[model samples]
Target: MRAVPRPAILGSIAAVLFLACVAPEDRGTDATNLRDPWAIRAEPGDPALAAGKEIFASCASCHLADAGGRSDGTIPRLAGQRAEILEWRLRGLQDGSIDLPVMTPFARALTEAEIRQVSAYLASLPRPERIGSASGGVNERGAKLYHDRCRSCHSAEADAVAASNAPRLCGQHEAYLLRRLEDMASGNAGGAGAARAVDPAMEAIAIALSMEDRLRVSRYLARSECD
Candidate 1:
């Protein structure tokens, strides 16, 4: 497994598990919107922001200076993300529900203002340009996989929206894609209450994936537009 970042590493695992059982309604982000994530409140050369920048140095390791997520998706992209969303997730990582080994220390050291600063810093960064499948090649395979196994409810691109509680797979991270699949396949994860799209007996969907194919499909999905 990859090294967890600071204390927040465990938060990733916890988030998934919590998300598995969390009602969709409860998952709402704390921030209003992220269209201009940094505009909530701040001034150029704000002193608190400067302090937040110093504190945010640690977060940069996994989140990247741009606040974009890990290429493998171990961490979700933070740039342009909703402020409340970022705060909520950070709080989740710090308090429990989210399991991040590294973030523990990080969170412990932070003050509310620091958190806001970091959130602002992340929001201020430019959003990444997401990418996805090359062409018909990967999509063909993904399509086959979707219909034969995933299509009962998750319609095309795993985007059934209201029909199912499952998350949209269109612009998800490829690395995260692989990890979630593995977790589901292992039966260690649970989201059935939220995802009627997955058939009761469909646990084998993970087993159906070959190592190579799984990687390929995930990469394709990750590259798609998330905006």
Candidate 2:
């Protein structure tokens, strides 16, 4: 048998000792941390907001001048979204966890500070009125589904709990919401690193819902009002 070098043997022992010293939470290989540093509020009159508005000019082409997005449900409204959620999504796009062809490039273009600034700016805007055509029928089934499964994280109150990661869904376009549900169910909503942005529980729920149930839930959220 070939003999191991003395230096190599010592190096292996040193490496093992170093790993043992690492804290449990700090030793994990997962790169995605949900409690991120970027999810912070920018107060009114903050310089970040001003710079963000200028930077948002590029986004206006697709999201519209007011960030209301397209009424046809091709785009999603950004106005009044939670700043934390916006920042998280932007970071996910930049890191390749959440991959949207149209959005990834835009997200990658921004620096860390720019991501925070733009998120705060978008969150400050007034949420637009319901922007698309509604299904215009009874949504009791959808409401029940939401109440049973979704309300805990996505509260229906005017002011949802800020600490939760869930984004507000009321008044979102039905088609867009439905498509997202489909994507989540099929495990196509995000990229390889999607575990950071896409909750396993959410994916399970989406998979459990039938096609018609998904549509009904989407319709219910689309017409629902929020503060």
Q: What is the C-alpha lDDT of each candidate?
A: 0.50, 0.60
Q: Taking the tens digit of each residue's C-alpha lDDT, what string does model 1 give over 152-175?
A: 544455432232233445555666
| Model 1: residues with Cα > 4 Å off, grouped in runs | 1-21, 24-51, 72-76, 99-105, 129-172, 187-217
Clash counts per candidate, in order, are: 24, 0
Q: What is candidate 1's local distance difference test score?
A: 0.50
Give lDDT tens digits, candidate 2, residues 1-227: 13223222211111111001111123242335444433446677889988778767665766777777655656666677667666655655666644444445555666788767877887788777554346768589998998888776567641233344456666777777777787778876533444445556777888999999999888888777765
Q: What's the distance in Å from true for residue 40, model 1?
A: 4.7
TM-score for each of the candidates = 0.53, 0.71
Best by lDDT: 2
Error of 2 at 222 (Å): 1.0
C-alpha positional error of residue 177 in candidate 1 after TM-score superposition, expressed in Å: 2.4
RMSD of 2: 14.0
